[model samples]
Target: MMVFTKYLEDFLMKCSTIGRNSATGRLAIGVGHESYESSHLQPSQWYGEVRELCGLANRPCTFPCTNNLSPSEAAEALNDHIASICQQLPPLDTTRLPAYLPARLIAPTVSQFQVLQKLEKTRVKRGTIPLDLPMHLIKEFAMELATPLTSIINASLQQSKCPSQWKTVFVTAIGKTQSPSSFGELRPIAITPLPSLLCESFATDWAYQDLAPSVDRRHFGNMRSSSTTHCLVSFLDFVLTHLDKRKSSVTSIFIDFKKAFDLVDHITVISKAAASMGIRECLFP
Candidate 1:
């Protein structure tokens, strides 16, 4: 599943279009489901597809809670806070940094990635908020710095025409293993033309919007059809909406019922839902 997710991410980064296709009236496909573990059966379903689901909400939240720390634990808590914030900062490495700053100044300042060069001559210790700094004040500073740093760094490296810049950004932004040659063609999630225009429309009924949930059994035949795009996007949007929400939380539980499909015990789920809707069916052959 990890391999599949990685491959899918790579594929999305490439061949997919980001703008409206006047030729086909379709834009791009939405992909859900991160590859967490491999399974013998496919993960898609009719009412809800499991494969495209994000694992965040079900996983455990690890962020250190303020309620559990002591006076001396403050530093450790601060480190946790810094680590969480650092994970979101733009990539940093020798090739991507300003030509002037020393390598020693990189990591610490990378938490403040946009302004590392600005403070190379000054000493801002890592994990140590200044004495006079209030907690909110430091957070505000980090947020303020994060905006321009991200904008400047992204603007500088996002050009597909420049191989050198793309290579560096590719290695830094996505990961070293990802190929820069194909990186330029990569697309960010849901930023495409069709999806962008219909963002609101799709948000309401993501799964039912375009393709039938059953289409996963085969490749899209009329791949260029507008209906295909809408359906696929809706299916994907459903997954992304859930995943996005999950990503913001900090805990998740991944359970694989020994025979998930065969032993699902769907009778309970079906009966309850159907009963409320005044419908009844065995729904099984």
Candidate 2:
């Protein structure tokens, strides 16, 4: 466990440093909203209303605008919010994490509606029977399986061989739009082994929280407390301010990659990471 955590911390630290150096002159931002169409709405017009709605619901709203304020006012509020969140976050401890945090092992409780909604959204065989397993049963099985799984994973880590079961995944295609009958517009979703999935999910969350503070705020692809809207607003504010001050046009370029994740070479990524972190041993040995 100590070895695993140290490896992750060291790797992430190096990755963060690489990210910061790479983003020296680049602007990165996130744009997140519950609804994708919300992007079309002008921030100045709907910011206050959405903020008020979020306040009434007692949740953190990621809307970029606040109180329908002017650009300067909105910029100030956004900066203050970012600063406050950054200040309030607890510092990451690099010594060692507990071998097994029970909270991390536990699966999140979901309501029946949520479960049904997920089932509805899943693109499985027409007339497929959904699993009737209860949360308690899953939890019990996970708890019982943890010891052996951990031992296997640790052994594999030492030997550099990943367990075959962890690599198995079931792929399903879901339509991009409502009531689509064609296959071309469908998106592929991979369903992985539950235990492995849960472990990876927990590890991802831990890494994100642990490394977020040290990561460059400009690089916002996958970090905690940052969203697409936040990125968009920040960039927009900067552009507006620049134009107003210098009365000069700004050039912007957008690049979209298709199947970006599928195109990545995992071996290259792992090799680069190992090299960057100075891990001399063969990762797969």
Candidate 3:
């Protein structure tokens, strides 16, 4: 797995170098948004395996391997990835603009109406009783429904007075997706938060607190040893501030890089890791 992660790390260094330069070339230019639906397989397990082999815990990403690559190689790889991103969109000039994130948020909302519907059903079920219902039981149901609604409403009201500063961006440089069909889809586009503001939750929030105790001791030890939350939050804030400045719409692509970890080209990743470490790419390749 470690070997595989090395390969993937190299690939990302190459890609990031490719992409970053492309972004710089047209900085003053505007952007636009596009809406489309695509399907793919989820490749997170593969990514995870490779990451484990590489002795990585938590979400595996490219930043760790950056230091290992030469400045020139890193720049080149970033250029490639940037070029890839540019290839997907309409041409941009000083006038045209794109807002990519909003469209991305909407697409998932459209795709998951069914899940939301299930939640509604759950809400209904929670309200119902066997007709031999106890009054106290009915009261409890009412209390249950009230809690989430109250929480949401209160949070909103509290936030109302605050500046609408939800501009955080979480970039998933590579990711995987699962389709209802037999196979999955994969892509190598950077995925920011739909609103860009909810990135805080992605990076900082604990989705479920109760499960922590049950997790393996090895995993816990790993978590303690390998943590980057503080640094990530600082970077997230920086990107959000930078991205939020666009006056025009930006093209945000919320893509699922299916089996991103597994599908990573091992040789490419290894090369990147080796380069980062001041080892010659030729030797590793």
Best by lDDT: 2
Candidate lDDT scores, in order, read: 0.35, 0.46, 0.38
- Please give the range of 10 consecutive residues that has the lowest summed lDDT in model 1: 188-197
Higher-lDDT candidate among 1 and 3?
3
Per-model TM-score, in order, reads 0.16, 0.45, 0.18
Instruction: Give the lDDT ranking, best first.
Output: 2, 3, 1
lDDT for model 3 comes to: 0.38
The window of 10 residues in a row where model 2 has the poorest summed lDDT is 23-32
- Name the TM-score of candidate 1: 0.16
Candidate 2 local Cα displacement, residue 211, angstroms: 7.1
Candidate 3 per-residue lDDT, tens place, 112-174, comes to: 233233233332233222322343543355435444433442343334222243332222234
lDDT of 1 by residue, 187-210 (tens): 212121211122222222332232
lDDT of 2 by residue, 1-285 (tens): 456545534654454455543423221222244431223333332333333433422343233233457867655654454344335434433233222222223322223343333333433332221332344444445445455555554455444455677776555445465444433344556666644554454345444554555567787676667789888998999789889975688888988975556555555544444344333232212
